[model samples]
Target: MRVSSLLRFRSTSLQTSIAKQQQYVPQHKPAVQDDIKRLEDFLISKPNILVLSGAGISTESGIPDYRSEGVGLYARTNHKPIQHLEFVKSSSVRKRYWARNFVGWPNFSSTQPNATHHALARFEREMRVQAVVTQNVDRLHTKAGSRNIVELHGSGYVVKCLSCEYRIDRHEFQTILATLNPAFKDAPDMIRPDGDVEIPVDYIENFHIPECPECGGNLKPEIVFFGDCVPRPRLDKIAEMVYNSDGLLVLGSSLLVFSGYRMVLQMKDLKLPVAIVNIGDTRADHLADIKISAKCGDVIPKLFDFRKTNPL
Candidate 1:
């Protein structure tokens, strides 16, 4: 699927008022015990499992995913994430993005790692999972104490100067942004994935975005925006992670994006055991040795519940 279509922007005219928009409450099919048992058995058979996680893993933390059945960001709203090229080429787009992000950052940045993240961390500590490659930019795995992690999409917690390579903590950048546009106190219509939100255009007309302190150039989040390629160096690192693993376990991702989907293909090519735990069908579902359609939170913690007395 083309990235542009995946994140197609909803025109301003089509946007409904927040009060008029139907609120999306997340729901999932009840997890089957049989599937959970199968996943546990799969994990037991493979000592060095590589975990590939996605946005669904973070949804239980109160963040939203992009493609969950009825509660995903795309399903809830007409808006989609910003296109990287548009952000880089248009000052107006940057202003609007920063404005909306500024409104949503407090909640997004404060989101904590949930049960699924903690369970994954425990699996890593026990040596059951060798590495975690996450498509999420939220950095919840780091917060959950997973030592070895590869953020397939770069983090949302860092900002970089596009022209000068200068970097700043996202918190510090938020402060700078706040100081620059003190009058932008407009409340957000809704919070989207990656700290983005839907805000009125009027709120953006006078919004002031800060430039790089060093080179007076553009400041952008460190995340790989929609329609952008993951840096080659990062890709190489992930490739090495895949090469070193004996098993592949997907957590909470639809694998709609090629980057994550390619890893599953690699696992198949290597003839490694592959399992997936997601709420819906994934692009690589047919190839998965075992596919469980359920929430990661409901399923991941149970893996450890069965092992609590036994210990891995």
Candidate 2:
């Protein structure tokens, strides 16, 4: 199906689901004190907890998520991101991808970490958190002072040569792009969460793409695109962290992707307690020992504050 058709279908399906829920479901309720206490107790019991975060965590910092109801990228547009195979095989695809990225880079790069990120960093500093494994490519965790982190998807701040070991900083590459395509330097500011923007095909066709200066190779972002595999070494490292940690605490993720969902499944296999903090239903909701439907920014700071006042 065409991208537009797919998006329209999804939008219609989502609208129908929302209408049905409005008719059948009761009004939303605020988080209860008992739920907060349960989460706090879980944290106190497991100091060496591994945190699994996803796009929802970064939404508070002004980056849009891919799957949030009525506000996600899927619900808002029909732009399908470049697939890994298409990028490797087609120069036309590469040209269009880089063009959109050029326009979106500034705003995407300027986003700062929010309260949830800072609270997680504090947890790491206090030795209460074992490590953080995130599915986001924005590097907000690193920016927030999180020392121990495993980025499930690689960072978007670096670009690598396909045929050589050469790497270039994305910001520096942006300067090169501006130099190559001066006409596009002043392009309208439209940014996406994945560092891509909407650009007309005619404009994209005129955009100049750069090759690896060091080896004349194709350049691509360091992110793990769809249809690409996460490096086995990274997976092994995350598995080790899960094995060593006392329990798992998921923050702001729906766990729709199998990669992030697998961690929750691993915790279940080990019979370790799992607690989730998200605004909606997650894939592992049934498996979680404690599930609190709330925003991570609101819940995490309160959790840390609760810990300070009532130390276990």
Candidate 3:
């Protein structure tokens, strides 16, 4: 999904608005309980499990998944890749991007990790989950307490100089952006889940773009933008974990992106035990060993609850 499609955000306010707009679908209904039960038992036997996650895990926290029905996070603009070239080549475009973020930040930043995130955290406490390979940039898993995690896409919490690679805290970058584009502080009106802000091109043109503090160069959000590739190191880390694992539990992810889908294929070819919990059709459904088609919010909490309360 395009960054813009995710949501217009630089902070949690963006999260509040998205939560208000999107409805939480009840998950883990009867259609998927058997699979959930089987998955719960399997974890008890294996103990050492590796978890792979995507946006679905974060949806319960109020962020919208890219492919879900209804007006998606990036519905109006359509999901289009925001490239490095556009940001560096056109000041107007970059300004608009920042403006969109300024208004959308609060709603996006306000989100908390949900039950699935906490379940993983609790499971990790049992010393069973080996690693967390996630496609989400939301950092909910980390907030939930999973330490051994690999973000296949870079995080949104930082920013870098596009020209110099000097990093800055996203908070610092936000200050600079707000200072330079004072007019845009209140300009944004639309929010998306991936945290992209929707603002007008005219507003962008009128805004003053900020320069990097270190080199007086262009700065971009420290995230893996669409059309940009994940570096080799991140992919290698995921592959290493997945290949080394006895089982792979894909929770709350549709596995649509090639970065993730390729990993799934890698696991399948290696014949690793693969299971999934997601609400919609996914590229890996046919490939999964145990497919539990349900909402993760309903499923994960219940799965853990069952593991604790019942003998199964």
TM-score of each: 0.87, 0.86, 0.83
Q: Which candidate leads the pack in lDDT? A: 2
Ranking by lDDT: 2, 1, 3
lDDT of 2: 0.84
| Stretch of 10 with least lDDT, candidate 2 | 20-29
Model 3, C-alpha of 47: deviation from truth (Å): 2.2
Better of 2 and 3 by lDDT: 2
- Shift of residue 36 alpha carbon in model 2, Å: 2.1
lDDT of 1: 0.83
Of models 1 and 2, which has the larger lDDT?
2
| TM-score of structure candidate 1 | 0.87
How far off is model 2, as Cα RMSD? 10.0
lDDT of each: 0.83, 0.84, 0.74
Flag regions of model 3 displaced more than 4 Å. 1-31, 74-81, 185-200, 306-312
- Mind giving the per-residue lDDT tens digits that candidate 2 earns over 35-145? 877887888889999999988888777677777776566766776756999999998999989998889888789888888899899899988899999999899999999
- Residue 129 CA error for candidate 3 (Å)? 1.1
Model 1 CA deviation exceeding 4 Å by range: 1-26, 186-198, 306-312
Q: Write the per-residue lDDT of candidate 3 for residues 139-236, one digit (tens) a residue.
A: 88889998998888877777788879688877766677677766665544455444556666667677665677778998787778767889988888
